[model samples]
Every structure is written in structure tokens, then in C-alpha cells.
Target: MTTVAFVLAGIAALIHVYIFRLESLAWTDPKTRAVFGTTAETAEVTKPLAYNQGFYNLFLAIIAVIGIAVGAFGSASSDDVSTALIHAACGSMVAAALVLATSDSSKLRGAVIQGVAPALAILALLLS
Candidate 1:
């Protein structure tokens, strides 16, 4: 369970960073723009949804770091580490997903990643 959490959290961090890049000037850089299908025009007018995504991602990265740090510090109990981190991560995901779902309704993957994965992860942890 810990391994699964770590891997997913790490991947989520990486992906969120990428999303941030796309929202920031990374979309302006030709080299960076190629990967995300963005253009300079977008750099001038960032979408609200994208900004929200970026903001959530920033929080996600911080939460992921906290999760790993707590694990390393030997505080994986319910009241201390595991419960707090998992609950936070799941909550972040749910909020992001809801924002995307209600705001845009186009970024299905964003909705799923942010909305669905966290709840499912929590359920899995409970079952285990």
C-alpha cells in the first residue's frame, strides 16, 4: 500500500509539474510547447481552468512531499502520517476533479486523475 501510494503520488507530482509548465511560459517556449500542444497565444491569456489546475498541482506536489517525508520519519500511523497525507491527497484530488468537471467539462483526464484516483486509493487502503 505504501509503495502504491508513493508511486502514484510521485507520478502525479511529475504530471502536475508538466501541467504547470504548460500553463506558465513553458507553453511559450517552442521546445516546450511541442510536447503539450500549446502556443504563444495561450501564454498571453491563460485559461482559468488551467490556472486552477496549476494551483492544485502546486498543492499536490507539496502534499506528496509531505507524504514521503512523514514516511521517512517513521510516522505512518493513522493519526499521524498515513491518514493525514492520504486524506489530504484524496481531498486535493477530489477538489481539482470537481473544479475541472464543473468548470470546463472538457478535460476528462484531469477530472479523472484529480477526482477519481484519490477516493479509490482511500478505499483500497481501507480494504487492505
Candidate 2:
């Protein structure tokens, strides 16, 4: 159960890292813009907002990674703390996805891509 939880959460972290790169470093790049279906001009106009949003994704990834590390190696007394961290990080991911879906049904696929692994990790942790 622990391994499953870790693996799923790690995947979620990696996904967010990719999102960070796309949003922060490549938002105006043609290929990145295509991935996001944004015109170059639109990308340029929204660059600052995307850059800021990218940091939010990075911070969530950091929290998830820290939770994984603590769950794997911290003292026994830290179990509750580790679990809480993991839940908070994963919960935020799920919440963000839900918001995206609610904002625009067209974004449902993106929402699922962003949220599924973390949702699974949370479920695995709870069932364990």
C-alpha cells in the first residue's frame, strides 16, 4: 500500500513538474502554445499569469514530494504529520481539477490528467 501510494504520488509530482516547465519556461514557445491551444499572441499576453500559476504547481509538487519523503523515512511519531501533508497536497490537486472542470466543461480532460494520479494516491493511502 505504501509503495502504491508513493508511486502514484510521485507520478503526480512529475506531471506537475512538466506543467511548471510548460507554464513558466515555454508558455510562449510555439510547441507549448500548441499543447495549450493558445495563439502566440495570447500566450504572450498571458505569460505573466502563467508564470505565476506555474509556481503554484511547483509548490504543490514540492509539498507532495516532501510528504513522500517523510512517509518513507521520517520517525514513527511523524506518521500523522506525513499523512496530513500528503492529504493536503493531494486534496488541493483534486480541488484544482474540480474547479477547472466546473469553469469549463471543455477542460474536463485536462482536469482528469491533472488530478487522477493524486486522487489514486489519496485513495491508496486511505485504504492502507
Candidate 3:
């Protein structure tokens, strides 16, 4: 169960990292704009906002990665710290997704994309 939890958390972290890259580094790129359903002008205008939001995602991913590393490789004494980190990171990810979903119905897909893995990871951890 621990392994399953960590793996799912890792997957969620990777997704967030990709999101960070898209929003922070490629928000105005044609492909990124297409994926986000934004016009080039809109993407350009919103680039600063996206960059800031991207860092938020990056930070969450980093937290989750830290949890995974501590849980998998750190001494047994650190288990509580590892669990706390994972719970906090995954919980925040879930909350952000819920906010996105509630803020706009059209963003449902994006919310699901952002939340599912973290939700699963949380479930796995709880069950474990």
C-alpha cells in the first residue's frame, strides 16, 4: 500500500510538473494555447498569471516528490513526517481541483485531470 500510494503520488507530481512547464514556459506557444483553448493574444496577455499559477503547481509537485523520497528512502523514524507531507500535498491538490471545478463548469475536465491521481493516492494511503 505504501508503494502504491507513493507511485500514485509520483504520477500526480509528474502531471503537475508538466502543467507547470506548459503554463510557465509555454503559455503563449501555439500548441499550449491550443491545448488550453486560449487565443494567442489571450495567452500572451495572461502569461504573467499563468507563470505564477505554474509555480504553485510546481511547488505542490515538489512537496509530493519530497514525500515520496522520504517515504521510500528515508529512515523509518521519518515515516510520520513523510506521511504528513504526502497528506498535505495531496490534500492541497484536491482542494485546488475542487475549486477549479466549482469555479467553472467548463473546467471540469481540467479539474479531473489535476485531481484524480492525488485523490487516488490519498485513498491508497488511507487504506494502507
Candidate 4:
């Protein structure tokens, strides 16, 4: 169960990293704009905001990855800290998704995309 939790957390972390790339690195690109349902002008105008948001995602991914590494490789003495880090990271991801979903009906799909793996990871961790 702990392994399952870590795997799901890893997937969630990877997804957030990809999101970071899309929002930070490719916000102005046509493909990224289309994925975000933004016009070129809107994308350009929002580039700064997206860049900041992307960093948040990246930070969350980093936290999750670190938690996974600690949990998998660290001494047993560190288990509690690793679990807390994973829980914090995944919980924040889920909360952000819930906010997104509630903020706009159209954003439900995006929220799901952002939330699922983290939610699963949390559940798995609880089971463990």
C-alpha cells in the first residue's frame, strides 16, 4: 500500500511538472494557448501570471518528489517526516483542484486533471 501511494504520488508529481512546463515555458505558444483555451493576446497578457503559477506547480512537484525519495530511501527514523511531507503536498494539490472546480464550471475538467493522481495517492497513503 505504501508503494502504491508512492507510485501515485510520483505520477501526480510528474503531472504537475508537465503543467509547469506548459504554463511557464510554453504559455505564449500556439499549442499551449489552444490547450489553455486562450487566444494569443490573452496568453500574452497572462504570461506573467501563468509563469508564477507554473512555479507553484513546480514547487509542489519538487516537494512530492522529495517526499517519495525520503520515504523510499531514507532510514526508518525518517518515515514520519516523509509521510507528513507527502500528505502535505498531495493535500494541497487536492485542495487546489477543488478550488478550481468550484470556481468555474468550465474548469471542472482541468480540476480533475490536476487532482486525480494526488487524490488517489492520499487515499493509498491512508490505507497504508
lDDT of 1 by residue, 44-72 (tens): 46555556656667777677667756665
Error of 3 at 58 (Å): 0.6
* TM-score winner, 2 or 4: 4
Each model's TM-score?
Answer: 0.66, 0.96, 0.97, 0.98
* Alpha-carbon RMSD, each predicted model: 3.7, 0.8, 0.8, 0.7
Candidate 4 lDDT over 1-128, as tens digits, reads: 99999999999999999999999999999989877889999998999999999999999999999999999999999888889989999999999999999998888998999999999999999999
Whole-structure CA lDDT of model 3? 0.94
Q: Where is model 2 more than 4 Å wrong at Cα?
A: none
Give the alpha carbon lDDT tens digit for every residue of 8-78 in model 2. Answer: 98899899889899999899999998878899899999999999999888998989999999989999888
lDDT of 1 at 3: 60
Predicted model with the maximum TM-score: 4
RMSD of 3: 0.8
Q: Which stretches of candidate 1 lie over 4 Å from their true place?
A: 29-39, 47-55, 76-79, 113-117
- Go through the candidates in order and give each one's C-alpha lDDT: 0.62, 0.90, 0.94, 0.94
lDDT of 3 by residue, 20-63 (tens): 99999999999999878899889989999999999999999999
TM-score of 2: 0.96
TM-score (C-alpha) between model 4 and the true structure:
0.98
Candidate 4: misplaced stretches above 4 Å?
A: none
Ten contiguous residues with the weakest lDDT in model 4: 31-40
